[model samples]
Target: MNKKVVVVTGAGGVLCSTLAQAFAKEGHLVAVLDLNQEAAVNVANAIVGAGGTAMGVMANVLEKDSLEAARKTIHSTFGPCDILVNGAGGNHPLGTTSKPYLEPQDLNSTVDGFKSFFDLDSAGIQFTFNLNFIGTLLPTQVFARDMVNREGCSILNISSMNAFTPLTKIPAYSGAKAAVSNFTQWLAVHFSKVGIRVNALAPGFFLTEQNRALLTEPDGSLTQRGQTIIDQTPMGKFGSPEDLVSTTLWLSGEGASFITGIVVPVDGGFSAFSGV
Candidate 1:
């Protein structure tokens, strides 16, 4: 395959950082994009040290102006983007409920910091929605414009297992991810004529900085929620970041030329099990 310019949003995060490195290793000119400029720079520097071409860029997927600026930088630095990995997404604490379910008594009860489902803040829900769903949409608008009719051009969306079925106590995240998966299919069909393949990866539980506290105790043992996830997962463990690398590369390369509009699960059988 010819060398291509790859852009990865949220490249500073654990999963995306690993992905950025993997793409760089494949001899692609990587544009490491993140809201956190420092983290993005670090990842890019590491890639450069390891003999990969990369440049850290600060961008906000929510804002078109920011993305446009990033586009100029990327185009001038490494030509138009051939691959875009929409990886900038995470859940918010305020969008989560203190308990998994709601009861009549809980609605009237007033406890400090205890939020029932009814207490879910609209702003929090909107923030989560915009972060995952709109975030993915806006970046595609800005970047995919350049990718149109470009050979080997493709998009990889970062979906979650929650996209398949709602997870407990995190309705906002689940809904947002579902939107992402839905949008992935929509984009695949929409861009098919233009030669941009769109697909998503609905990853199972992987302990990252965003969900570290929720999945593990302070002592590093699995939390109750984490254990529950493990029990449901036939593999009985969290996936390593590296585990996702091969599939990501496959979808980005010509090997998956005929594949599009599918959400591949890297969840280690989590999606296949029915909890029976």
Candidate 2:
């Protein structure tokens, strides 16, 4: 089997780390890039320990220079990246409102650290938007330069269910993810002639480290918000990270050579459900 070079940003995270490991298991030379060098090394070391080829490198998806540096390192280490996964994105507390909807008297009342839509921090909104949208964009700009004419080279952007519809209390995250989905289609169309297929994976309600506290309690029980998600989802449960692996592998491989510019949902029917 020909070993392809696969690069996954945010590979240190629970979900992306799984992707990195899976790619390595399939005999691809996986480059696990993350902002945290130690966390990335842990994931890469695990893959190497299992006798798969992988390397961990520090990379900030929001920074072009950081991505360019990482790209150079990847090219020198494992050759040009045949597959790029832009998985660096997350929401912030300050970007979220304390309540789903604003109340009449609530607007007049004063409470310490009570963040409402009116009080949402500008810096927080900017950070969240940049993290999810620009984070995906900058990395693609740096990596896709190498993939332009390469055979079987593709890009996968990680979007979210919020891209399809706005979720309450998380306007910033929802908007950012929407941008990611839109960018996927734009890139796919622009790069179609170059043979670089660009697509997006809009994963629904996966209980990852980034949202663990919000979704689950320390007692291993689902929070009220989490239960509401499960109730809305047609499958009546949260999706496992492994559930997305097959689709991701298929999309990244030649098996889905004709698939591009689409946002494949791996949300256990979450996206298909309506509150009927």
Candidate 3:
């Protein structure tokens, strides 16, 4: 079989690393992209050490020029991208609200504890929007072009649970991921005639660095917030990085040739449950 070339952005990240490894295991040439050059290289090196073809490239999601350069470098090393994973998005603290609800004290108290919606900084909002929405958009522009006439070519975006329902304290992230899901549909339609599939993965409540504070206590036990999340989820547990691999592989391979424009949730039924 001809080897496919897959590009996974934020390859140093836990989920992306797992996807990259899965692609390599299938004998595909993998490009590990990350803002952190060292970590991306580390993942690529591990793949190479395992006798797989891999290369690391640093590309900032917010920067078009960096993505262009990375695309060129990847082309020189691994040919065109068969599978593109937009996995570089996350939240900024400034874009977050302090609490879930609007309390009466929030109106009177001048304390910094609650960053009201009215006080959301413009830069903060822009940063989150740029990171999650624009970040995914720009990379698709840079990489998916090569997928136009190719078989088994697809784009997988990393969306959030907040996209399905608004999560509190993160209006920017929620809106941005909502945009991401909408854009996935848009791209899928736009690219459908050309054989390029666009889809997204909405992961629910993983204990990654993005949500570590909410999930784990200082001593590493589950926090109250974590327990609350588990109780709300039908599966009553968080997902492991490994849990995402099967879907990732299926989406990237010929098995999912007819599937496109869908955001698959690997959230242990968190999105399906209603806290009942």
Candidate 4:
């Protein structure tokens, strides 16, 4: 395997951190980029402690200047990025509805903190859209320049099952992920001439710190929403961070050289079931 410099945005997060470590394990130089400096450094340090080469970088995916700064640091430390993983994305509470369905009285409801579809904050929606879609786009713009015309270079985006089927109460997140999936295809075609392969992984529900409270109770039991997700999923459970490692590695390596413009679903059959 070629030892490439792999830059993973949001590497501090559970899923992306796993991807970062996996790349390092394969002898690639890893740039663990995150908005939180401490989290990024911790993950990078852990990889180094395990005998892998990695560096932590602070970057905000939504800001072009921040990403450019990160790219400069990565270039100086590990050379140009050969593999870019756009993993910096998440949902905001204001972009989500308090309930799955709006009631007849919701328009006139006086309940505290009640948010319906009509009540969704515009700022929250924009933030979600920018974080997921623009977050992926900006990173590619900044890091993909190094990959142009380079052999074995690739880009991996973290899409979500919500892209295939919209999840209730989180229209902003679902729509944003859908945009990501669409952009993956667009980017794959756009980068084809440059020999840089672009693809996305539409993951199913994974139990990460970002969604732990929504999925599980304090006692480790499933919440109502989590139970619904499990029942809908053919696998009957939430996915683990480790569950995504192999697919991510496969997509990043030469094994998937011929694969591009495709969004692989790693959702354990969640996308296949129709709830019949």
Computed on alpha carbons, the lDDT of every model, listed in order, comes to: 0.95, 0.92, 0.89, 0.94
Error of 4 at 9 (Å): 0.3
lDDT of 2 by residue, 52-169 (tens): 9999999998889998899999999898888999999999998999889899877876888788799899899999999999999899888888888779999999999999989999
Clashing pairs in 4: none
Per-prediction TM-score, please?
0.98, 0.98, 0.96, 0.98
Off by over 4 Å in 4: none
* Cα-lDDT of candidate 1: 0.95
Model 2 scores a C-alpha lDDT of 0.92
Position 74, candidate 2: lDDT: 90
Looking at model 2, report the run of 10 residues with the lowest lDDT sum: 105-114
Which tens-of-lDDT digit does each residue in 150-253 have in candidate 1?
78899999999999989999999999999999999999999999999999998898989899999999999998899999999999999999999999999989
- A best-first ranking of the candidates according to their lDDT comes to 1, 4, 2, 3
lDDT of 4: 0.94
Evaluate model 4: give its TM-score.
0.98
| Candidate 3 residue lDDT tens string, 1-276 | 769999999899888888899889989999999999999999999999999889989999889999999999998877888899999888887888777788877767678555877667889889999999999999999999898987779999999899999888889999999999999999999999999999999988777887898789989989877888889899888998988889888887788889999999999999888787
Candidate 4's displacement at residue 230, Å, is: 0.6
